[model samples]
Target: MPTDADDRVYYVISDLHVGGDEQLGEVEALPELLAFLERLERTDENAELIINGDAFGLWEITSVEGTDKFDYLTDTYPRLFEQLRTTGDDVTITLLPGNHDHELAAYDEYVDRFAAYNVTLVQDDSFTRRVGDRVVYFEHGHQQDPNNRIEDWGNPDASPLGYYYNTLVTSRAGQLSDRGRYNWLKDVQAVTPTERMPVWLLSKYFYREMNPLLRYALVPFLLLFNVSAVLAVLAGLSLADIWSTPVEEGTAFLGQFGAAGTALWFLLAVNVAIAGLLLLVGIPLYFLRRDVRKTIDRFGVFETTLTVDAEEPYEKAARERFAADEETAIYCYGHTHRPALSEVDGGVLVNSGTWLKRLHRRDGAIGVLPPVFYPSYQLCAVRIAAEADSVAVEFEEIRKPSPSTEELTLTERLLTLGRKPDPELPDRAEIPNGRSATPPEPAE
Candidate 1:
């Protein structure tokens, strides 16, 4: 028997990444997350909660394997599971497997366990729903990504390259991140390129591990090092008495110059010494960076996405998928952890970014001195509802304010010092209805 629930408002969120061990604490916004579910109970009592994918971090499981994970997850996140059960009374809960938690699809026992809580486990590769006049297509979205696309899905032994990378790199980082005050570094798995890891890791060290005094001191030191070379050249010429070429026209040049020149030379000489010290340090540092890059390259990566300026692979695939069947006007997915809303194929495509705190280096501000990891949260849910003739997708950011939310990175502070203080407000954006057509594919 089939039932229709068109009036039901749909809510989708993904990438909670509840880790295998004690990593359940990684869900930073516990209060707000529970608040959101409670809101669902009060507002749309029978609304469906489709956790599009990556609900649990099976890849992060280090010790337990086989059906043991079922108990481990339930034990670790008893409160969360209990909340799900309570919420299931009003809202139908659904879980799908993303690349990180492909094991959910590997075993049928997982389905039975979830069934106890009245939660529906979507084992299919993709799911769809009708919204007003349009059909919305949903998937975990790793299929389009080669590294994460599992050819032999649903086999406990079968693992993708992404799974291995997470186990080796991400698990190691997450373990260390837990020691830091904020465990945002655990989510570093989302960042790509085998090379980016060292820089990103260094940024974490600067922010989380480094002594406050040393971290603050390094800023001015970096600035001074940049202009030190020019200062050194000036001092070298001044010391050679080039500025004191006994003026044949007048001794006035020497008399007034003598007083200022001595003072100036002293400062210049200091600059030369500092610059010399910097060069002593910088030369080795420059070589060290090169060595690190080479080492990471040698360690190798399974795949690196070569994303272009405007044409992201997921967006491209969405547009083509929509074009293939004119019925589907909306394509939504998770896994990118980037909240995106773009116009394509006469409809819209949206990404339900992850709940985990994301870290991106804001290199635009500083000219690349150990790129700063700006901690941010895309913590959001995509709401789909029937519109006049088509369906509309809205991104609702769920906030749990902490001191870290407003705190600026050292680099961000230095860059925006003179500018009018940023007018920080709640995360609310007036999204434009449409955008330029997806640019033509790069010429072959």
Candidate 2:
């Protein structure tokens, strides 16, 4: 709600990560975005669309520099640019720079270039808009993130920890993605918490890139690994005269099937032997790993968890803002790519989520297989407007099917049969005038 206009509406989205090099340049939700923009163009309401942050994957565009990156994006996504131009004519459109697209703030040329397409680029880290009697604070939410926070906000040379990560890992993945068997390396950005990327790569390599013959040959051994370890333990106990031999009984049962049974028993014996050797070695390795971890802790090598707790800093900032301004009713942002809405003090803390593909990790039901990263789409627009005596916030999802069939191998699909992600969002929430009601339960 704008103080000057009671009917004004705000639509917010973030982390589009639209522009990149080669395979990374692919925008999976481009159709939905185009349709959304067209709808905005047709709307009669007084609307303002704000791209909270990381709208462009400027960090992934390593081939170009400065405003040339903007040129590349415009040329590459002419349709999207046209839609933005059309939508901007009817509704005010604002773009905020996030960690990936920090170059937008670093270069003055971006302001003019984006304006040519009717996108008003906001160079500051955060801004506030009045909603009825209260105010809503808007930011990309990267300032509170240590890895992405820019010490010199608008300085071109101000590369944070996240900058190098995008350069070396994300961009490189884009350049090399097509070389992979399934062309999936470009999705390196979708793995949340950043720490899961290595495991994700291993999973993809095993399921998609590994040789089928080798994989199948090893499947039986892997599937029976735990059973073999137990059998090996029982065999050791029998050898030590502490227990009867279950291994012998099991092999005798198998031997009743003749040559095939003998072969199966031989395989089992080999497996047991290997498992026993691994167990003996693993015992020492486990202790060694613990000692190494302790030493690393002593040296303070990893002071923080792989996935930083995104809630603490942002919530702390929200609390501070609430304490400072009694009129502030909403603190909305989008950098962590998690769509969430909950009451903070009397106000609501909201995350806009992302337009990019989201990967939900699903552990293997059994065995030591790497976890499958189930892909899904959470394309959404967060709408905020006036609602009588209270401020209303709503999350509207743009439905789109995930590319699991194309992205995941058959094994991955079989392993994660019934565990598809179905994330819940609070359909609509109200920030009361009194600022005392509990937040509504998230929609089922």
Candidate 3:
């Protein structure tokens, strides 16, 4: 850490993923972002805002290539560019390239263009910032990910697996999002762990795109699937004379309701029949899927876990950096979109999370419905600076209401009632002059 730079405060954020064609261009927190910049402009402290990586979604821009992507971004988001200019005038703003915006390093035009707007495009994969006597290493964190890692940092043709993902799926969704009954497909980026895409698509189709009549008609069967399965088992046991009493009692109990009793019996019978058929078919499909997965694994075709077990790689990387540079007190990054603050080898590790609407997977309270992706915002800026004799780190959450009412279906809301993401971040984390103790718990 540099001694002369001790007085300056640093604000870090990443994975804003701005700029794409059509629905991908929609930044739900645009107002919040502008307000954050405006607040920075009015601050009295000496501050530098470091966008660690992925300030733009250059990879998702199917409409343009190379420098034209920046032009498209500036044209599409004039207000954002204008705000960046305004904020840059007041606060030092710096940007580094992530996998999504690797083009920032590839094209030399981006440096001058970003400079015109007051953002210093670093054109590198990683860099270090100093706060007091401690150093914080900043990277996009994609280098740890096999699918997104770029072997050649500035090569224009170096496309990783993640590049194809954005191009084929995310960009395509953006272009066709409006064609859906609800513009839900645009949120494909919010679905973490790329493996969840198929399930997410199914959930969206059922809750948002499926015809209302068909959905409503099938709701009863889906909701009572478990009950039906249990009843089928009970029926089989009764036929075998192992559990005959319960069935007789249940039938007699319903028989007292006359016509309604008849209807109830009919529904139950249909449910049992459907359950039996499903069991027979699902058994074969389950084994088939297992076999396919095993074959794929054997061949090592798709060996990525996407977002699963996201922390280990970054944590290991952070520890390596700490070992390599003993002066380093913080390792800051964003890529997993999961914000965390934890002690690592006498130092602190920080993930700056994303400004994009986060999708928290919520399973059905009962039955076998597809997991509902509840939407919320964890928009935050990590501030690190000198506080007296110690180096201090604090998280500042940009408050935004969960878009549940607007984004979720009534069925989804009911199924996931009283359940929504409320992530906690340590209000303040500090490393003492000697770096001997663990940080305290978050403030109440």
lDDT of each: 0.68, 0.87, 0.87
**Which residue runs of candidate 3 sit more than 4 Å off their true CA positions?**
1-4, 257-263, 277-303, 440-444
Steric clash count of candidate 1: 0
Question: What digit string (tens of lDDT, one per residue) describes model 3 on residues 1-444?
Answer: 112465899999999999886899998888999999999988887889999898899889998888998889888889989999998987889999999999889989889999999998998899998777778899999998988999999999889988998988889999999999999899988888778889999999999999988988888778799999988888888999998987899999999999999999999999998997888889899999999999999997765765435788888998899999988889999998887888889999888999988888888888788889999988999998887878888899899998999988898989887887677766578898786326758532
Q: What's the TM-score of every candidate structure?
A: 0.76, 0.93, 0.92
Following a full C-alpha superposition, what root-mean-square deviation does model 1 have from the true structure?
A: 6.8
lDDT of 1 by residue, 1-444 (tens): 113667656798987787643443366766677788778766633478889898888887777887788888888778788888888877877788898788888889889999887689988778888765567788988887776788887877766777787777677666666677555565565564345677877766776567878877886666655566765555555668775332222334334688786675555457668887766688899999999988888986423643212237777888788778777777788787766666665666677878776655555354335655555555779887764444556777787443333555555556544542221222322212242223222211
Superposition TM-score, candidate 3 onto the true structure: 0.92
- CA lDDT of 282 in candidate 3? 90
Tell me how candidate 3 scores on lDDT: 0.87
Error of 2 at 380 (Å): 0.7
Ranking by lDDT: 3, 2, 1
Per-residue lDDT for 233 in model 2? 95
Residue 153 accuracy (lDDT) in model 2: 94
Model 1 regions more than 4 Å off: 23-25, 178-187, 190-195, 211-220, 230-311, 364-369, 402-444
Deviation of model 2 at 239, angstroms: 3.6
Worst 10-residue lDDT window for candidate 3 reads 435-444
All candidates: CA RMSD (Å): 6.8, 2.4, 2.9
